[model samples]
Target: MQMSNRIKEIIEVILNSKGYVTIGEIAKQINVSDRTVYREIPEVTEIMREYGVQLNTVSKKGMAAVGSLEDMKSLRISLGMEKQIYIVDPRERIDFILLYLLQQDDYIKTEALAIDHHTSVPTVRNDLKKVKEQLGVYDLHLIQKKGEGILLTGSEIEKNALMINILLNHADEATLYQWLRREGDVSNPFTKRMEEYGYLDVMSACYLRMKNIIRDQCELPAMIKDREYLEYILLIAMMIGCHQKGQPYEKVFETENFKGEEQRVTRQVKRELEEEFHILLSQEEEQYIKWVLHMGMIQDTSSVYTVKNRILDSKIHTFIEYVEDRMGLQLIRDKELKESLYVHIERALTRIRSGMCISNPLIEDVKKDYEELFGIIREGADRIFQDDFFPDDEIGYLVLYFAVSLDKVMKRSFRILVVCSGGMGSSKMLAHRVEQEIPEICVSKEVSLVGFGQENLDEYDLILSTIPLYIDKRNYLKVSPLLSSNELEQIHEAIKRHKYKTMRKITVREQERRQLESRDNIESLETLRLLMDTGLRVIRQFRIVETREKDLKNNLLRILSEESLCSLPETEEKMKKQQSYYIPVTDMVYYEAVLARMPEPKLFAAHYHDDQYLSNGEKYTDVIYAVYPDQASEYEKNILNRMLESVIEDRDIQEMIHRADEKGVRQWFGYQFKQYLAELLAV
Candidate 1:
């Protein structure tokens, strides 16, 4: 960690540059000798690693930092170069100073704060004045405790929000994620910085330990999937995880209100907090968990509203209409979905009014998973609440409401056969897992390896076999007996294959196609949606379901063809007919689709790569990716056409396709996506 000034300068230069730089170039820029530059290279590399940066060297191509933009942002904080990099200015320092004061249990001496920040006492006093003004924003206050130095006061939740805000303002998503990963690892470079940010080692570790315990010992609902949100609530558990000396003056919690599931989560969480962190959760802390999980805690909606729904009926209806228009889905009519959204908004508004800021750990996941829908709801909320910008956490709840509602109406479930090894114990366990985890797929029968041969495989739309089969088939995936995350992903993709296949069949019916074709003036976005109607969407993730010695490429191509996106035969014929066009792009593994789009091509390709290698080193895995392009606008062709060309050349394009929110994925194929991608990719 003791790096020379020259070495630090080299890192700063390399980090600032997007492309690689030669050693000679680096030495010349820094005005150092070639030998000095060479000598410092090792130290520079060590420095980068110590600061969470991976220096990528392309041999003769020279070196540059290889990581996300968030990593680079974290690097500034890691090295204490935040000041040098202008990562946080004086005005921002005041905000952090305020957060520090708020977290103080007793009055913190103003002189001590000044010394800590390397500023003079008067400057610290001036900072406290500004801090007071800033706390006013969260409806909090700075007060002088009698017989103590200086105290900052706020409601417990508001104080917690200030702490969370301070942490988030300095740390990016990658930093927050690394903080969790660094838990219990004392030697971690991030550990020192995390403590510097006010998280005690025992407390932070307790949050993560509790998470693993819950996953192993209990079954959690799907809505409880966000890791950040989990950690935030656990942070609450950590805060409340201390020995209590006295009882509450008044009991507000009605134990009768907690259904079986809420009671289960509360009991397990309470026991773990006591054993792991040594603090029995007070009733208030128990209530915190229930409040945090309200989105998931509401078990039955069968109860008639004894109280008028928390949110205004008219406001919910208007918001629903806006969502329907933007998303092109009917949500307003779904009574169940409307009620769900209503209760969430009502509870959220009540919390917001009380200065209680709840964090959504899965906000990133939700945004990544449902980008466009999130955007529409965000816009809708802004319209409804003219005075305030809705928090992302609230918007995340809306995403959950609509995603579940839409999936209920849009999804078409398929029956699958579970083919396991001869052991009934393992096969039945796998079958139970498939039923429990994958609600979308219904298992029709559980058959053994020997029994599978005798049973009618064609009766089931998809087959999941644990062992290799002699049968050559399309809708099949070979998984392990354990059924890990990797296998779950496989099951997910297989289900998509059947769903898209069915959608393709229903959409391409002569009647629907004829009616669809008659509309010529469709918006580019509408045309994009039309592709979904034509079954043109790619499976979000591709799985290696193909057997060895099989023509995986052809089988995968046939699957993509089933989507009606494009036909391999049709694209090949067009390649022969066209005089000139850009070459097609493929990763040769995950990207098995044809990416070359003509100015007025019939369809955009979206296929999966199989597990076999042809002479050219390409294989199809599961579904064929071909698109039957309808009449798209010049704008649509121009944007998506560019994405197809870029997808072949850029790794980020490939990744962003997988990781980006729905709108982000759709926009990537367009010229606009490239513009936005460049700005964020460096981070």
Candidate 2:
């Protein structure tokens, strides 16, 4: 059925939102009344159904079009919103024009070129000026005849290099992979332009086969298995496919002399291609592949060290010394930093010498964040290299290396113990995350619940656990295995608290210690009084029940309302507004577990179970709900957070909750409370 433009606009707004879009939001976006939008809902829903999209609406939270990305793309195409023939952006138009001319062997008329681009002859003429300057970089020329339109005059080798450069500069490896695999958005500007020249079709045919040949046949270094190597394989495949299809740049030439290893690897690549694809590679093609492979290997320090360049090494040492003297730092002492810098500088020098440009996508970000450091490095590079050969892109990369080294040298490291349910994969992952996110932390050990219980707690400055520690240990914080931003801030605060305590202890005299002990006794008494009151209320209200409800939202409503913990509408609204509060804990086990928070301030804990699939397609068999008071003191908040973490991390607690063992749950809570009291009085 044909839909009106208003209905299409409403559908577009719904599809664009990542989450639920309210009726008011849609109305405002389309400049219509809420009533008019309501009138169009049925028609919009009907049209969406044809594309396998479901229009899901909630009472308070508006509506969302739920479907696969492909379905959405198809719906957009049906609405005539996906592909545009004419390029609008001037920069993009120049790129497409260059690609168009390079793919053609015969000279075309200016009018035909203008018609293909859907632009005027004057605009095409203006774009050709910039294109000419770009061509000059590779020693290529744009020759125009009075009658004939234009022709790209250059060696096959130089033209091929320019083509590869354009592709690299246009998209990064991830985007290229998506395009080559036919997984990228078809309407993207780059994809649309490349498709106009049939580049996508050629890449789709050669991508997987070339990937396999490179992986199985080439003797690649360990460190070169990243994006750089992927790009190298992509370019080689493109050159080969373009040659086989009788493209303009297919002339063969004699191979140039290369290193023994590069020649051997290139021969294997050529043999594999000829055997598998039934096409022989010319010597010039072999030479190009060999050169590309060598360039990729230069990024790997281990591979570069295999063939030492004394001059490059000497220059790098001098560069490091210059930066060290300027910044009053001892960077020369860092061996790893020196090695990484050497590899990057070597790659940068090669690209510079060969008139090749490497794009740094993060150059602007690096300049903004480290403006002063960027200037110093740029100056050092200019002085050491005897000219300003390094562009801002290369300078930006160098700045990152020194920035990281400087961070490590300046930050004070503290020993930490990372605890989890098991001292295995999950614990190691958490440990790595802590060290990566908080460089000030040095993980002293990764321990399981059982291992943590037996260790001397005073050995480490702080203990971070993915699960709850029932015992009330000082300097302990419960954190998610995958730490979020808020949790990171909490960790920083915990470090500050520990530092303050340590300073107080160090400065205290014997008399001050005695006085502090006397004051602590009074505070301990008050803490005990508050703990008993909160503990009784929590233990009395704790609940565990086995449920048969299959729908997650329905089960949440039933549990929350039936227990009188929170009202149904409040729970529903919270669920709709904050979907992120519902977290999936693990999927390695037979039954998936999810933890959810309640909006209410009352202390409440419960377990509900049913056989259902989570949004991620995991089969969820259990849901643990934890509600902490909105107005809670530090001690109370810590207790509730740890309790929730225990439900998330402790397998035993999970098993008990899943079994709906009320007796066991109560007993565990009592024991944990006792431990908390004992630790409090001891302190």
Cα RMSD (angstroms) for every candidate in the order listed? 16.6, 18.3
Instruction: Output the TM-score of candidate 1.
Output: 0.41
lDDT string, candidate 1, 154-254, tens digits: 55556656666555554555445555555211222223344665465554566576666456644454435454454455345335522332322122333
Q: For each candidate, what is the lDDT? A: 0.57, 0.67
- Model 1 segments beyond 4 Å from truth? 1-3, 10-95, 105-115, 118-139, 144-150, 168-174, 180-198, 217-221, 241-258, 295-315, 321-347, 353-355, 359-683
lDDT of 1 at 230: 42
Task: Tell me the deviation in Å of residue 619 in model 2.
Answer: 50
C-alpha RMSD between model 1 and the true structure: 16.6
User: Could you say which candidate leads in TM-score?
Assistant: 2
**Per-residue alpha-carbon lDDT of model 2 for 465-499, expressed as tens digits?**
98889864223677888888977876776566454
* RMSD value for candidate 2: 18.3
TM-score of each: 0.41, 0.50
Q: Which residue pairs show collisions in model 2? A: 601-629
Best by lDDT: 2
